[model samples]
Target: MTFSIVGRSDDGKAVGVAVASKFLGVGAAVPAALADVGAVATQSYANLAYRPQALALLGTGVSASAALAGLIAADDGPVSHRQAGIVGMTGPGATFTGADCHDWAGGAAGDGYAAQGNMLAGPSVIAGMEQTWLGSSGALPYRLLAALRAGDQAGGDRRGRQSAALLVVSPGRGYGGTSDVWVDLRVDDHVDPVAELGRLLTMHSLYFESPEPSSLIALTGPVAEEVRALLAAAGFGGEELEEELASWAGVENLEMRVVKGSIDPLVLTHLRAAG
Candidate 1:
């Protein structure tokens, strides 16, 4: 009923999970992560307690393998029906597919990543996810999303897709640098949840991520004049261009991309499109 990957960044500063399933709201059930700790995905009659319990073990310095083993040992419910993947900040990942899980159920694990699924089309789904995750580059969220998409393309859950989710975490990576949750997007129900999840991730990047320093354009000369005109057209004109622009960006939920003396090209593009 589900396919998922649990992973951490090369530097061990980020960890996350991406999952899709025929089940409703798989995100809320399968994925859990903590910056500098680890990540977990529990499904196939998922015992929700496994999420927090595994994190607690990781917080206490347990390896992914040990944490998962302990959870299975302690579980009071039918352990034979559960599936999970765990990845720690500094060691190899671990995965488990209970004996009673539906056909085509299995998992793979290695340094920094794990892939697993049950009720899948075939082993190719997990293979495709692992290949993409190992070969991909860039931010952790994009890599995770790419791997999830790979699984979807490789004949994902035989039961078909109903929902999908992406979650990533890192120290001080959340909004205003106040939380560890860098990305958390979900599609609880959709005809094409994986693609929809990708779309939401793109919007999340624009609204929440800061621009690269090299992508910033100084707000002076023609750029400044153009911005002023655009702001005025948007009914945001003011003597203080920065202040008015900040206000406009706040309204547009692009405040995180706003810089005092410069504008991100993406933000500028949005301004022009709005005008």
Candidate 2:
């Protein structure tokens, strides 16, 4: 019914999951993670309780294999119908596919990552995902998304696609640096849920991702005048152009891409478009 990748960044700074399924709202039930703890994806008659319980176990210093074992041991449900993948921040990963799972169901685990799929087109679904995760570069979220997209290309859930999700966690990565809930976008229902999730992820990056200092351009000369005009048109301009621009960017939820003394190229383009 679903396919997913659970992983910790190679740099060990983040943990996340990317998943897609024929089932509606698979995101709500299949993925879970905690920064510096671990990530898990439970499907094939997913045990929702396995979410928090597995994270708790990982938080308590349990290995991925041990944590998954604990979850299965305590479960009284139809064990043979369950499928799961676990990856902890500091240990080898693990995966499971109950014998009773639908045909074409199984999984694989490797250093810092695990991938699993049940009722997939074939074993290539998980294999393509694993290959992508290993060879991909860039941020953790993109790598996870690439893995999911690779799975989809390999023929994802056997039935069809309905929903997809990406969950990432890192201390202080959330909005305003107030939480660990970084990158929690979901496409509950879409004809092409994976593609939709990718678009949402891009929007998330634009709105929430921080720009490098080197990427910022000081607002000066003609650029300053341009910014001033944009701010004035937006009814946020005042005697202090720099302060007004920052405030306006904040109001538009574009502050993360703008600096106090400089304008990010992306932010400048946004301001131009908005004005």
In terms of lDDT, the best-performing candidate is 1
lDDT of 2 by residue, 10-49 (tens): 8888999999999889899999999889899999999999
TM-score of 2: 0.97
* Candidate 1 lDDT tens digits, 1-275: 89999999987899999999998888989999988899999999999999999999999998999999999999999999999999999899999999999989999999999999999999999999999999987899999999999999999999898999999999999999999999999999998999999999999999999899999999999999999999999999899999999999999999999987999999999999999
Clashes of each: 0, 0
| Candidate 1 residue pairs in clash (backbone atoms < 3 Å) | none
Root-mean-square deviation of Cα positions for candidate 2 versus the true structure, in angstroms: 1.1
Q: How many backbone clashes does candidate 2 have?
A: 0
TM-score of each: 0.99, 0.97
Which ten contiguous residues of candidate 2 have the minimum total lDDT?
254-263
* Alpha-carbon lDDT of model 1: 0.95
